[model samples]
Target: MPYDFGTWDRNCNAEQSQPLTGTLTGTIPSWLRGSLVCNGPGLMKYGDHEFKHVFDGSAMLQKFTISETGMTYTSKFIKSFAYTTNTEHQQIVVSEFGTRGCSVTKGFLSKLGSKFQFDKMFSDNPPVTLARFGGAYYATTEAPFLHRIDLDTLETGEKVNLHKLLNLNSQCPHPVTLADGATVNVHSAVGPLGPRYEVVKFPPTCPAGADSVFAKPVKLASCETRWKLNPCHMHTFGLTEHYALLPEQPLTVDVTAMVANTIKDKPLIEGMEWLKDKQVKYRILSLETGKELKLKVKSESFFYMHIANCYEEADHLVFDVTTFETPSLLHQFKLENLRTKGSALAGEVDSGCIRRYVVPLNESVKAAPEENLVKLPGAQATAHRQKDGTIFLTSQKLSDVAYENPVVNPAMERKPYNFFYGISGDMTSNKASVGKVNVRTAEVTRWDAPDDVYAASIAFAPRPGATAEDDGVLLVHCVHAERRRVSLWLLSAADLSDIASASFTLATDAPRALHAVYMP
Candidate 1:
C-alpha cells in the first residue's frame, strides 16, 4: 500500500487537549508507570505556504502516560516564539535551518532589511530530541537554547538560552547523563577566524547565581582550530566513561556563504560545503585531564547523524555510528518530490550502514616504510598505525541494516553493550517496523507492522527489578496511514513479540517522529 501523504499533510495541526479514548489489546503491565514523550515536526504547512524541507516544520510534543490500569494519549505544539509568531501572522515569517523567509517587500533593500531581523533566525522548534535535565523536561534541537516542557501537562515552558547562561553558542541535542546525575554536552561556535568546541558539565540541580536559573555549565575541555571554517556539521558526538570522541567530518561550514545566503534569503543548509578531500578527524579528549589527542582516519566522504555508543577497551577506543555516503538523503525528504515521484522507488537510496571504528591509543612498534612516511600536510595528522604498522583506525561493518533513531539499553550506555533497537525499513518503503540487532553476533530480529501501519522510533522501558540487559519492554509508536489513527505497541525485548497494544483516534494524523524518550 502507498503512503497517504495527503492525510499526513492534513494532520499537521496542533493536537487537542482531550485524551484519546480507545481499546486496549492484551493486558497493561501493572508495574508500568510513567510517560513516553516523542518529539518531531508536526506542522508542515503554514496557511497557504508549505515548508520546503520536512525538518522545517514547527515542533509537536506527543505524550503517552502509562498507568497501572491503562494508557492515555495527548499532544500539543511547543509554543516557541517562532511557532506563536508564525501562527499569529498565518505565514512562515521565521527563518528555519532549511527554510528561508520571504521578504516583507520586493528588492535588495527589503532583503537586506530582513537579514537584520536576527530574531527571525531563532527557530525554537525543538523537534529533534526529548531530554530530561535538572528535573525538568526539555525539547532540544541543534540550536543553542533548550525549550522547557512541563512533564505533567505537556505544556511548553520558557526557552532557556545556553548562550546567555554559559556563553555557549551551539549545543548538541543529545546530552549524556552520568551515574551521579551530572549531565555533559558539547557546544560549538564558529567565527570569522575559525571554530572552537567546548565540553560543558551541568549539575543535577540549578546552581546559585543570576544566570543560573538552570544548571550552571562548567567547561571541562576546549579545542580551537585556525582552519578559517567550521569543519563538520555535527549533530551529536561520542562519549565514553573516560573520554569524549568528536568525529569531525568533511562537511565544512562556509561562514561567508552563510552570511551571503541569509542576505539573499536563501536556505542556510546550502551554505554547508562538503570537502571531499578532507579526512575525518577524531578529537579524543580525556575527561579527567582535558588533554586532547588528534587521530586522523581515511574513509570515503560520508555523513553520520548519530553515534550509537562509545567505550574504551584497554588501549583501544571503540564506537559505533550510523553513516551516510552523501547528503542525498535530504533530497528524499522533499514532500513535493515524494508526492510526484512516489515512494516506491526510494529503495535505491543507499544511505550507508552501521559500522564500528576502533582506534588504537598505544604507539606502534613497527615503523612506517620510508616511502610511506610522507610529510604531515596542513593540520591533518598522519593516520595512526596499529602495533603491526597498519593504519590504526580499523572499521568493522556490523550490519547491512539501514536504520536510524537508534537506542541501546540505558544502563549499558558508556559501557560495553550488545543489543540496539531502532525503526527499520528501506529508504523508499513506507512500511516501517521495529528491529533489534545484536552487536556482538550481528543477529537481527524484527517485528513488522501491518501493510497500512508505519512504526516510528522505539523507546526501551526498563522493567523494574530486572536483572538481564534485555529485560524490558520496547515501546513503539505506530501510525495507520489510510485509517488515520495512531497507537503504542509494547513489545517483548527478548523476542520483539507484541506483549500489548493501545490504539487511539486523533483529529489529525501524527507526523513521523525523529526521536522519543521513555521516562520511568
Candidate 2:
C-alpha cells in the first residue's frame, strides 16, 4: 500500500525566532519539567530554487518545553553559513546529500547550473540527528560539522569544524553518549593509507564553563574495513560496555563517484552503490584496550541504519538491530518517490525486520559448520564457524512489527534490556504507530495513531527513581498537516498508554522531525 508522506514535509515560516504558546489537550505530569528538542528538515524551498531531495532541506531546531502551566512551542533555523548564505541570496547555495546547490532562478530543480564539487560546495546543514560532541549539544548530520544550539533559547551558537582537530573527513551522525558522560562515535578518514575507520571517544566536558572540547577525544581505535575507495556508509553503529560494534554492510559510498557526480551537478546518493556479492561483517573494537579485536565475523548481506540495543556477556556478544534485506532503502526517501509511493514502507516491506544476532567472542573454541555457538535459552540466532576460519552469523526475526527508530532507556544502554521503543508499523499497512517490544516474551505492543495523523520517531525518557527499565515515558512528535496542527504525545512506557497529548494548532512552525531527545 502506498502511504502519502506529504504531510511530513513541512516548511519553516518567515520568523527567524519566536516562541508560540500551544494548547494542551490533557494533563502534563508536573514532574515532567523539561523540553523535547527535535531537529530535521524544516525548509524545503528558497525563493525559486527548491531542494530536490528529502535530506536537502534547511536545518531547524524545534522545541516543546513542558512546564507546570502548560506546553509551549518554539523554533529557530540553524544559523549555519549555508542557511545564512542561502537566505542572503534567496536561493540554494550549498549542496546536500541529494540536492545540488546551483545558481538558477527559474528552471528544473535538478538541472540548475553547476560545477560545484563536494568539498568546494560542502554544506553546514546538520539536520539529521542532534548529539553532544563534548561540552554542548550540536545539530549533527554525517558531515564533519556540528552546529551548536541552545536548547532553551532556541539559538544557534558556534559552529565547530571537526575535521580541523582530527583526520576525520566524516563522522557518523549517531554518537552514542554513555551514562558516564562519555560519547562513543565512529569517524572515517581517507588518505594515503587508503581508508581507516576509527572508533573515537569524547570524554565528558563541563558544559558550564568549558570554552572548547576539541581535544576531548582520549582514544581512536581503528578498525579494518573491506573497501578502500568505497567504504560502507556508517549512518549508525552499536556500542557495548566493552567495545564498539562497527558494521560494514554491502552498501558503500563511492568517493570517486561522489566527486564525479558533483562535477556533473548531480546529487550525492548517485555515488552510492550496493555490492550484492559482499557479505556483511561486524568488527569489534575493545573500549578497554582502545584497539580492534580483529575478529573475522561475517554474515549474509543486510542493510541497516539503526541499532536498538547491544550488550556483552562473558562468552557472547549480543545486539539487536533493524535490518533490511535489500539496499533499495537508499532511494525510497526521495521527495518525488515519497509523493507517489509515500514513506509507509515497513520492515517487512522487503524483508525489513528487527533481528538479534549473537556472536561467540571466544574465538578459540572449535565447532563444526552446523554447530550453533549461541548457548542462551530460546535463542534462534546462530554463530557457526566456517571452514575458512570465519564465524558466520545468522539471525531470526525478533518481532513482526517494525521498530525503525529503536531506542532503549538511557540507563539501560550498553547493558541487558528486555523492552525497547520506536516508531512501529504494520507490515501490511503504511501508517506508523509507536511500538514497544518485549524480547523475552516475544510480544509486541503498540499505540496506534488516529486516522489522518502521522507519528514520527519515539524516544524513551526514564522517570525519576525508576524501578524497571520500562518505567518511564515515551515522547513522540506527530503532525496533522491537513488540520494545520502538530502535537506531542506522552505515552507511559510501562503500558504504552497515553498519559497526555499537547496539541498546537497555532501553526507554530512545528514540522515532522527526524529524531528527538527528552532533557529533564
Candidate 3:
C-alpha cells in the first residue's frame, strides 16, 4: 500500500487540557472530557501525567488534542541543537550541543525558572532526521556529524563524523584554486539526507526498507563541489529506507575565466542549471559490504520530489516526481529493487502511477486576500506521506509571502554559501496552505489557513475507529502574524479540512522550514 502523511498549523486562542490524561497510539493522543482552558506551551510535559514539553524556539507548547475526560493533551516536539565549533562560517552555531535538547519553551523557562539552562547543548545546524539504535537516539546535524544519545535514560553518547562516512574529503579535492598561484583551503560538504531534500537509504538490519529508520549508516560515495562552488546541494530518493539514492549535481567552474579577467556576466543561478541534460543518478549501497549499486533515470521527464515509506502487510516505495516545470507527481515501486538480483534494472524501475497537484494562484479567491498576493515559486514546498498512503503537501499560496527575493539571493550572483546561494522563495509568510493527494485515486484537495501564519511543518495524528475517509487528523505548528506567538490546528485527515484551532506562546518563532516529531 502507498501512504502520504500530512500536518496542520493554525491561528487562534483556544482551550487546552491540563494534567493530560488518556491513551496515545502512534503520534496521536486521545483526549477525554475537560473544561475549556486557555493554552500554554504545546510541549508534552511529563509532570504528574501532564507530560509538558516545549518545542524548541516555541514560547509555549501548543496542545494538539485533549481527551473527552480532560486527562491527556497530545502534542508534537520540534528540536534544535548546537554542535562543535567551526570558525569558517561564524554563522554556524556550535555551542550548547545535544541530541533532542534545544526546545523553545525550555529555552525560555530555563531563563525564568532557573532550570539548568538546557539551551547550551545546541546543535551547529538543525537536525534533518533522528534514528534510534541500541536504545540510543542518533541524529544528523548540520555540523556534518551525527550525535548519539541514550533514548531510555536521555544521556549523551559518542559522535560519528558524517563527512567521513560519505567520504567527502577523499572524493572531493582540497585546496581550491585561487588567482595568482594561490590556493584556499576548501572542502565539499554533504547535503541534508531525508525524503525530499536529502539522500535516501535504509539504515541497518531491517527486513523491509519501508517504515524502517537508519539503524547503522555506512558510507556509500561522495562528490566534490558539484552543485556549486560550495555545493550545499541536497538530494532525495524514491525507495523507503530500503535504498541509498544520490543525485548528481555536476561541478562547474568559471568556463570563461581562463580566457580573460573580464567580469563574465555569467550568473551563479545559471551556472547551477548549466547542464540540464546531466541526469541525477543514485547509488544503492550495501550496509554490510560498502559496495554501491548505481541507477540512473530519465532526468528530463522527472525531477526528484520526495520518497514515501509503506509498511503494511507488504513493503512498498513511492517516489514523488515532477518535471523541471510541472506539477508534483508520485511514482510507486516495489522495495525489491534495492537488492542485488532484483536491482539489476534499478535504472529501469517502473514509473508506476502518477499523481500531480498544483496550487491555483492565478484563479480569483471568493474572499479578498488580507495581504499582498502570495508569491509564486513556493514550488519549494515540502511533503509528508502518511501511513495510509495519503500525501499532504504545503503550497506557496499563503499571503504576505515573498516568492522570489533578490535581497536573499545576492550571494547567488557572487557564488554565495553552498545551500543558501540557490535558495528561492520567501519562507516567511503569515498564511500558508496544504494540499492532500490520494495515492489510490490520484485525487487532490486543499486547505488554506490565515495570513502571517507560519505552518510549514505538518504531521499526521493517529486516529482510532476512523476509516480512510474519516480516520486521521492533520497537526500543524503555525506562527501567527504577530510574531513570537505560535498556534496549532487539527484538521480532518481525509479531506484536508480544518478541525480546531488553538493558540500558545513560544520563546521565539520557529524557523520557517524546521522539523517536528510526534510522540504517542
Candidate 4:
C-alpha cells in the first residue's frame, strides 16, 4: 500500500484539546522539566478552498510540557487574517505561497479589478517555525508580518510587521540569537540602489509602548543584489563569532512579477523563479564593524535550506548546511504533487546532503587560480582563487546520508561540535532515516522507523552537568500514518535508541510540522 497523504487535506486544529495527558507507550524521564514549543502548518484548507503547497496552511501552535508529574499536550491554530477571512467567506479569500482564491481566475476581468483587493493578495499566516525576539515568542514565516503568541497558553498577541520599521518585504525565518540577547536576521529590501539585502539586528530591549518591538532596528550591513530587480531568496544564513555569511543562491524573487501578480490576482509564489545556472555568491559581513568584506566568493549554484553551524577555526571560517543540487526540492512540494506522489515525495528530498564549506580569512592574500587556500587539516573542503578575482569554494559531504533540519546542542551552537541529529519528512521509507551523524568520522547511526510512521525534525534537551555533547534525550514528533495517531517520541541521545519508558502519545494525529524547539 502507498503512504496516506490525507492529513494534508484536513484541518487538525478544529477542536480544542488541552492539558491532555499522554497514554505513555514508554516511560518518560523523571528529571525532564520544561516544555517543547512547536509551530507549523495545521489548517490546510477550508470550505471549497484548499492550499496548493504544504507551507500554505494556517499556523498551528503546539506545546508538550514534560515534568515529573508526567506530560500534557495542547494545540491551537493562530487567528491570522488568512485563516479568519477564509473561514468567514467559506473559501480561500487570500493568496498564499502558491494558492489563490478561485475568483482570481473566474475571468480576466475579475483579475483586472483584483487590484482594488490588493490587501487580500497577500497573507500573514506564519506556519514556518517559532522564533524568539526581544524575549517574546513569535510564529514567523517568510512574510514581513510575525504573529506573536504566548508560549504558555498558545494565545495570539499583537502582530508586528518588520516593514513598518524597515523597508523589507521578506524576513528569514531562521535567525541567529546572540549572547547579549540581541537577535540577528537577514532582510530583503529595494531602495534607490535597486534590490539589496541587509543584516538587521533587534536588540533585547523594547519601548514601553510601541507599534513594533523591532522599531529602530540597527542595520549591520547591506549589499546590492546581482540583478537590478530580482533578489535571491534567503531561507537562512551562517553566523560565526565575527562574520555573517549570506548565500545568494540562484533562486530569486522577481519584483516585477510580484507586483503584477498582486494586480492580476495571482499567487505571489508565481514571481519566484529558480535559476539553476546562476552561481552562488557568498557575501561575508563583519559583525563588529557592520560592513561588508570586499571578498568575491563564489561557488557552483545550489539551494541551501539550513545552516547547522558556522565558526572560526584556525584562521578559516567553516560552515555546514543542507544543500540541494537544484530547486526541485521546493517545486516538488506542491500540494497536488504531495498527494499524488505520496511515498515518492520522500525520495525527492533525499537528494539533499550536508555540505561543509571553508573560506580563507586573510584579507590580502594572493594565490594562483588552482592553488587551494584552505589549509585546515582533516577538512576535505577547499577554496581556490579564480582568475576572475572570485574565491571559488569547493565543499565535501559531511556525511553520506541525506537529511533535513540538521541540529546540534544549543550550547555548542556557532562553535565546533560533533554528533548532530537529524529527522526526515518521511521516515516510513528506506531512502531517509532519523539518525545522528558524526561529523569528524562521517559515520551515520540511524534508528529506522517502523512501518507507517513519519517523523519530524529532532529537538534536544541536555542533561544537567553533562560533559558529552549528546548527553540529553532527543524529542521527535512522530505520526503513525496508518493508525491515525501522533506522539512525541524520546530517544537516548547517547545512541539513537528508543526510550520506550518516557514518550507521550497525542490525543489525535498532529498536523505536519517542519521544525520545533526545546525550551528548558
Candidate 5:
C-alpha cells in the first residue's frame, strides 16, 4: 500500500487504556533508561460530527517507557474541560482557535460566556508541546493554562492558570530553560489600544513553599505595539543569553474585526488579515535592561512557524527559522484538502526553508538611525537604534530542503551550537525524513524514511556525562501506511545510524505529532 495523507486522521481510540508492551529490535543501549512523552491531536471526530481543522481534534498524550528489558506504551486523552464537554454533550460546544462552534447561537453564547468564565471555553488540548518546569511536567498549548500530567501514569492533573498565576493572557508552548533551571516563555495580551508582549521567567522549584501558592513569574521584558492590533500570529520566539527576539509578521488580527466575526459565527482564522505590503519587524529586547531595538526588513511576505536556535556573537544576535511564503499553509490542513489525495493536495503548499538572520546591536537607545545602520541585499531594510545603542540587520538562506520542528541540545540553547536535527521534506511532498545540519558548515546528513512510512519529528537524548556535543541518541516516531502500525526508532546522533527500534500495532493510524520531548 502507498502512503495516504488522509489516513493519518483515523481515530485510534487509545484513550486512557492499559499499557501495551512491545518487543525491542536491534540492540538497546544499556544506558538509555527513561520515558519519551509526546502529545498531539488524537480524536478527530465527536459523535457524528468531524473536525474541520486538525487543530480542533482533542489532545492525546502518549508515553513510552524504555528499560533494559523492553518498552511499554500508554496513551490517554487529556480530559480537558472542552474535551469532556464535547464528549458528554456529543457536540463541539466550545470554540477553538480555528474551529468555531456547531451553531451561530451556541458559538455567540459561548464567546459571551468565555469573557466571564474563561475555563468554560478554554481548550486545554496541549497538543503543541510538552514542557518540564518547576519540577513538574506539563502539557501545554497556545492557551494561557498548562495542564499538569503524571509522568508515569499519563493522567491529567490540575490545570495551572497562567493568567491568575502571572497575569498573562496567553503563552507559547515552546519555552527555553536557562542554565540555572529557570524556564522562560513569551506571553501576549490584546487590549483595546494595542497588544502587549512580555517575557516571563519561572523558577525551577516553587519558592512559595506550597503547591497552591506557586511562585509568581518574574517579568524579564515587555513592549507594546503602536498599531492597536495584535502583531501577527506568533507560534514561537527566539532567545539568547542577553536578548529576546520577537518577529512581528505582516499577518495581524484586528480586535474590532474579530469581535464582529465572532458574533457572526465565523472561524477565528478567517478574521486574520495578511498585509503583503508591510515589512516584517524584528523587535530585540535587552535581557539586562528593559530596552528595545526595532529592525524592519523588506522581503517577500513570509510567516515563521518554528525557531531552530539562537545565539549571540561579539555585537550581533543571530537566529534560524523555518519560513513559509504565506499563511496559506494553514488552509491546506482543512479536511477537504486532506481527503483529496494525489497531485490535487500534494505539492500544493509551499515548502518552508531554514533561514538565518543577524542583527547588530547598539549601545544606546537614542543613537541616530543612520549612525550604525547597515543594510544587506534583500527586499527592504530599516534600522533604528534603541535608547541604549544602534543595530544592523542581515539574513541568509541555509538549507536546501524544507525543515520544521527543529531541535537542539538543551544544554546548548541560548548559547553557540553547531548541529540542528529536525524533520525535513519538500513542501509539496507528503513524505518526511530526519536530517541533521551543521550550521557552521553547510553540510547536511539525512536518513530518508521508506516510501511506505511517514516520519515525525526527532528528539535528542544526550548521553549521560558525555563530552562531545553530538554524543547522544535521536528518537523518532514513524507510522507505516499499509499496516497502520506505529514504531519508535532510536538512531545514533553522530551519523543517523539505526541503533534500535520498538514496533507496536495500533487499532487505527496514529496521528502525526507536532512536537515531542525525551525525559532522561
Candidate 6:
C-alpha cells in the first residue's frame, strides 16, 4: 500500500511525500529536522585540520587537540562538547558532506533543480553509517552502492555494490526509503544475463545451512496498488560489520476477502493471496547467513523509529523496541555469547534491562487529529546510549490523557480542529520531559524541562579517569528550550540536574531534533 498524506491530518500544510504524520506531511519542521540529525559525531582529518562535526542540529566544526587531559575538541557553539584527551591531531575542517537537505520539505516535495531532494535519492530508511579518516570519510547517498572519498584527495574511491555486498539482487528495494513516501517506478529491462534476475555477486553466499532461506524476496503476484497502506513497519535494520540485522512486522493479506472486497475493475492477487489475518512477524536477521530470528519483544508499531544506538557498555547494540499498541521499550543486546544460528533471533545470553515508557497519544500531544489517546500518526523518538550503560530516550508525554471528542465512531469528523485545545485543557508544557533508565538496575528517572523545551539529543562525557560516581557530566540539546532556538545543556551525569546552559538563536527556528553526535 502506498502512503496517503492527506488521510492523517488535513491541517498539515507542508507537502510531504508520505503519510507518516507528525510534522508537516509527516515531516519534521526544518528546525526540528536538524534537531534529530545531531546523533553521532564524525571525525574528518584534513591535513592539519582535525574537523569534528559536533552535532546540535546545525553542524559545528571544531579543532581537535590532544593533551594530558586525553582528547579535547573545541566548538564555536556556545556550550562546548568536551573530550577528555587523546593523541589525535587538532585542526580546522569542514565537510562538503553536509546534510543533503533539511528533512522537512526536502523529503516530501517533488521538485527538480531544488537544493533539496527526496531522502530517497540517498538511503534514509535504516540507520546509515558515516565514517571519517584523514581528510576523508565514507558514506552512501544511494542504494546498491557505497562510496568512499579522501577529503584531501578529492578522489572517489572504489564503489562497494550493496547488492553484491548483501547478496540481494534487484529484488530488494535498494534497502532505502523515500524521506517522503514516493516511489520511482523503474521498468524492468533485459540485462546482459537475460531477464535481469537480481543477482548477488559481491558479498559471497551465506554460510552453508544458515537461515539464508528464511526471508525469500517477497514475490507479489501484482504490485500493491490497491491494498490499504499500513504505516507501521515490522523492523528497520541498521548495519553492522559482516551483518545487516533487519527487523520486520509481517503484512496481513487475505485472498478470499481481498477478492470479495474488490470494487475496482480488476484485482491482482497471485502468489500471496492467502495473507489476510496473519499477525505480522517481527524479528532480526544475520546478513552474512541470511538468518531471520524472532525477537521475544512486543510494543506499539511504528513506521519511523530510531532502531539502534551504539553503546560500548551494551556490547555495542542498544535498540528501542515497541509494538504498535504496546508501551515503548528499550532493549540492550550484547554480542557476547549471543548466537545467530537459532530460531530465537534475540535472547538473554548476557543481561540488560527493559523499561516502560509512553509517548502521549492524545489530540493535544499528537500533531494530527485522529490520534486521541497515544495513537498519533508518525510520532518519532530516539534513545541515546551514554558512554555508560544508561539510556536516555526523548518522547512527548502528554499532560492530559483524555479528549472530549473521542473518535470512537467513523462518522465523527475524520480530522478535528480545536481538538488539541480540548485535550490540553489542563496540560502543562514542562510535563513532557526526557527520561533516563539504568540498564543494570532498571532504575528510572525523569527530568522536567521547561514546557517549550523539547529534549532532542542527550550525550555523556566522563572526567578523565573518573569512576561511575565521577562520570557525572552530560551534553543535551533542547531544540526549542529557548524559544524556537537551539540550546545546549551541561548537566550532572549522575543526576540530570542542569549545571550550565548556553543558547544560540537560530537564523531560522526549527523543531526539536532526535539525534546528535558528540565530540570531545
Off by over 4 Å in 2: 103-121, 206-211, 340-351, 425-430, 481-483, 508-510
Go through the candidates in order and give each one's C-alpha lDDT. 0.73, 0.77, 0.31, 0.76, 0.73, 0.28
Candidate 1 has its poorest 10 consecutive residues by lDDT at 372-381
TM-scores for every candidate against the unseen true structure: 0.91, 0.92, 0.44, 0.92, 0.89, 0.37
Count of steric clashes across candidates, in order: 1, 1, 70, 8, 15, 58
- Candidate 1 on 1-520: residue-level lDDT in tens? 5554443343367685887755689887777788888888888777886787778888888888888778888888998877887888778888887788655556887757767564555566788877767767688987787888886788988788766565566788998878777788888865455578888788777777634435556777767742456556778888887788888878766778887878777776778787777667778787888868654434445788888888876666677888877766666666666666665536546646777776666644465533222232221223345443445353566667655788888988878788888776454455676778887876788888767677876799888999898999999987777545778889898899888888887777667777888987
**Winner of 4 and 5 under TM-score:** 4
Best by lDDT: 2
The residue-by-residue lDDT of candidate 5 on 372-409, one tens digit each, is 44333331223445443424344567787667888887
| lDDT of candidate 6 over 39-157, digit per residue (tens) | 22322232343322112122222222222222222222111111101112232211121222211124323322222221222222111322332222333222343345332222345
Query: What is candidate 3's CA lDDT for residue 326?
Result: 22
Residue-level lDDT of model 3, residues 72-110, one tens digit each, is 332322232332222222222222111122123345544
Could you give me the TM-score of model 1 versus the true structure? 0.91
lDDT of 2 by residue, 168-239 (tens): 778889898877667878998765678888788877873444456655576657855678888898899888
Name the better of 3 and 6 by lDDT. Answer: 3
- Comparing 3 with 4 on TM-score, the higher-scoring candidate is 4
The order of the candidates by TM-score, greatest first, is 4, 2, 1, 5, 3, 6
Better of 2 and 5 by TM-score: 2
Q: In model 1, which regions exceed 4 Å deviation?
A: 1-11, 103-114, 190-193, 210-215, 225-227, 365-392, 428-430
Of candidate 3, the 10-residue stretch with the lowest lDDT total is 416-425
Looking at model 6, which ten-residue stretch has the lowest summed lDDT?
Answer: 4-13
